[model samples]
Target: YLDVDLSLDQVHLYLCEYLRMKDLEGPYNAELVPVVTKAHRSDAVPSLTQHELDAILFEVTEANENPEYPAVAVLFQYDAAVAHNALGVTGKAQWGVLAGYDRERQLARIIDANAKAFGRSWSVTCEWLLQAITGYGYIVMRHVGRLLRRQSVRGSASM
Candidate 1:
């Protein structure tokens, strides 16, 4: 209906590239992570669970106290409304962010583009949120101070 329909992979890359470009942006660059998928993967896929997400976030938070990529968020792909169970789109592959959580309150906030429930962000019970989300893997966003040179050592040797 619009112009051209894009696959999830394309969408993911677009998002990643967008963030990379945002590195030129002012404040957003200070805390941005680019790329949405593994170079060899086509889709993010459902590979994680709610509990796993919680653990990852907790670790990221703890690390951010003094480490790299201080900010990390989960992008969930599910078949429910971004905000409430009865407020927006459903029965489709909708995406949203698990901005953060409150273990004490047992709540997780969902930030969405089609949000209308809680003014672009919705706070729902973790149980409900987990039940409604799919793993689909999300990129751990961060602020890169400089280019990172990665290394590879294989062939069963330290090299």
Candidate 2:
């Protein structure tokens, strides 16, 4: 239903959300680093102000349970790539390039799992239908109302 033209970058953002959900990473959240808007030389690394750095550190620190060396280090690397525009190319390609694929697999798994769950009761189907309908325009709403009413009549007759 969303008709906006999503660039590869925007698609990456959706992928991030999908990966986080599939990983069951409850506390994990990612925000695009503002550095993406800045013009930078190909060889220059993106820089963050102290506050941005602190916020990122806070997220990772909070995510850590034991704060052991390797765990913190890995967490730091993950967040750092996102916080800087370092997610662009080669030397940092493992973080950025790989995230795209990781997110794709995670999204596919979630879609598959959701499709399986959709084979459920009529209550679920109705709930989903209602939620979707409510997001539409007034003219669409009238059609949805008539459809629901017809469905209700048919449902009662079957009972």
Candidate 3:
């Protein structure tokens, strides 16, 4: 059994907020979808394979299920579908006080991981992936950009 310090309601709210910030919503919240058009990124570079997608999903599920934040599992599953449906990157908008990592750090880690995996900056990788998948990457980039903007504002405000 996973033990979380926060109530389930709190986790749910955070999940919704994250989705709102990302502009990803709808039935199943599935951002990933079949694409009939050939994307420039995929044509120029290699396409993202189902195997890669499965691996990423596995990692996210494991992270979400970590006992530190019990509600994270549900939140993750919910957001992932939303992001997938929107063709959004599955790792953005990783907010909340769950699973031991704060929202910002979680976003950063995922961005960094994508950058390392794709040999591009976080934003570039997100764009490439979205283009590869059809259009979901744009949604992820928007949320990540929002987070970056917020951080910048907060930093300037602190001065």
Candidate 4:
């Protein structure tokens, strides 16, 4: 069983397989787009190159049928604030999700799943990402793909 704060790598692996199954069903396919390091994050400034970032943006933006917006999220480790907005765990290296951007305020929008535990402590400067990340790991920018099919098949029969 996965703890609430499951490691991002494990979650990503499960998701990639699930999406691959969906793609094989001949409805929709959301392939892994960005190339990143296979190892766990240890780098201080995990980042996405301009070309990769642009490609993700273009693909997501092109999907006019997307419900809320693009299905992409930026995952990285950080020195999360230990005060009230910690990532629901102490002692563990903090991680956060880059969901959206606020051009006006100039901040990378952070939307952690444990938002309730930490409150809505979102929005950090691009500079914070550059300087605060834990290591020099490559960024894992992912698109949480859509299933053109009906509901999610979540049990033993899902595959």
Candidate 4 residue-wise lDDT, 13-125, digit = tens: 76567657766324333333222333344442333443333333233333433646444444555555532244545554455555655545645666654665444557666
Q: What tens digits encode model 2's per-residue C-alpha lDDT throughout 1-159?
A: 111233334544564666467872343333333232123345544343323333323333333345342122110112212222234422221111110112222110001111222221111121222222121101101111122222333323221
Sort the candidates on TM-score, descending order. Answer: 1, 4, 2, 3
RMSD (CA, Å), each prediction: 8.8, 22.5, 15.5, 11.2
Better-scoring candidate (TM-score), 1 or 3: 1
Model 1, 52-158: lDDT tens digits are: 54564454444345434444445555446533667555545555666666667867766764464235776777656555544233444444442211112112222
The C-alpha stretches of model 1 lying farther than 4 A from their native spots are 1-7, 24-46, 59-70, 81-83, 86-89, 116-118, 135-137, 144-159
Ranking by lDDT: 1, 4, 3, 2
lDDT of 2: 0.26
The numbered model that scores best in lDDT is: 1
The better candidate by TM-score, 1 or 2, is: 1
How much is 149 displaced in model 3, in angstroms? 27
| Pairs in clash, predicted candidate 4 | 43-134, 43-135, 43-136, 44-134, 44-135, 44-136, 45-135
| lDDT digits (tens) for residues 1-159 of candidate 3 | 112343344544554576677665431132222232354344544333433333333334444454553222212212232322344545433221112222233221222212232333222132333333332221111222122222333323231
After superposition, which runs of candidate 3 have C-alpha atoms over 4 Å from their true positions? 1-37, 41-43, 67-132, 138-159
**Per-model TM-score versus the true fold:** 0.54, 0.26, 0.24, 0.49
Candidate 2 vs 4: which has more lDDT: 4
